[model samples]
Target: MSTLEPVEITAGSLHLRPWRPGDADAVFAVCQDPEIQRWTTIPSPYHRDDATGFVDGRSPANWATGTAAQFAVVDATSGELLASVGLQDLRDPAGHPGVAPGGDGEVGYWCAATARGRGVVTSAVEVLCRWGFGPLELARIRWIALTGNEASRRVAVKAGFAIDPAPRSLPHPRDGVIANFWTGVLLP
Candidate 1:
């Protein structure tokens, strides 16, 4: 394992930080939004316990294992969490399959209902990708958005992710098939 501990990431209007126990309420509030449950992998009808586990267990557990990095997106001024962002499928950015033992890193993010349409998520994602590409030595950063997810697609494009077709059956966190996917590479 890299033994690189998770740390806070800051963008202009957003900060990506490790989730704290006190974050449960804010997180739960965000999760409760209908749009969140409708679009993202978060369980429909997400209960308080889900938020608890996300804060107290999931994020910290990933750090301990060095397998994932999850950040709570917060307002830069107030330090209030507005959403979550994650870098998953840990591996180098060099596109080397064998030399890099881990899988390709995938960036995932969501914005709070209140924060939607305000450019917060896009700004956060761009900064996060830049940080990941440089220090993490990433070969390619893939952004996958389900078809018709215009918001996600727009963010990827704004962040310099080129749109291209990816295989269907992309194994969405939700139960059904995702007919289309968009993938973009961060060129060296």
Candidate 2:
């Protein structure tokens, strides 16, 4: 695994950094939004414990092992959690699956309810894609959304992703059912 540190990234009005323990409350609140639950893999009934586990455990562990590089998008001036974005399923050149492996990374993100419609996520995603191409040396970054997730599709398009015409099946994290999904790709 790569021992490289998760560096903070800054954009015009926002900054991205690893999640901290103090972020649990914000995480919990945002994850409770109906829109977030409907579109992403976050626990449908998100609870404090889930948020705690994510900020205190999962986020740190991912960083330490280089399995994923998750970030908390915050307001540069106020330091509020505007959203979450990550480059997941990072692999190496040999195409071995997992942390620090060589290959493409999947981009995932969710914007807080209050922060939607302002292009917060789209801007953050653009910053992350540039980081993936530069510091992370990623060849390509992929995006996927359930077929009806038009908001997410728009963000991908705004961030320069080329949406694929074909739809594929993506398994729901909480249920065994698979749903039709759309995919997009951005090459470095």
| C-alpha RMSD of each candidate structure in angstroms | 3.1, 1.4
Candidate 1 ranges with C-alpha deviation above 4 Å = 92-103, 176-179
For candidate 2, the 10 contiguous residues with the lowest summed lDDT are 94-103
Q: Would you give me the overall lDDT of model 1?
A: 0.75
Number of clashes in every candidate structure? 3, 7
Runs in model 2 lying further than 4 Å from the true structure: 98-102
* Whole-model Cα lDDT of every candidate shown, in order: 0.75, 0.89
Query: Judged by TM-score, which candidate is best?
Result: 2
**What tens digits encode model 2's per-residue C-alpha lDDT throughout 107-180?**
99999998999999999999999998887778889899999999999999999999999999878767869889
Q: Candidate 2: how large is its RMSD?
A: 1.4
Index of the highest-lDDT prediction: 2
Q: TM per model?
A: 0.86, 0.95
Model 1, 21-112: lDDT tens per residue?
A: 99988888888888778667787899999999988998788777655678889998998777788876666435432113323577888888
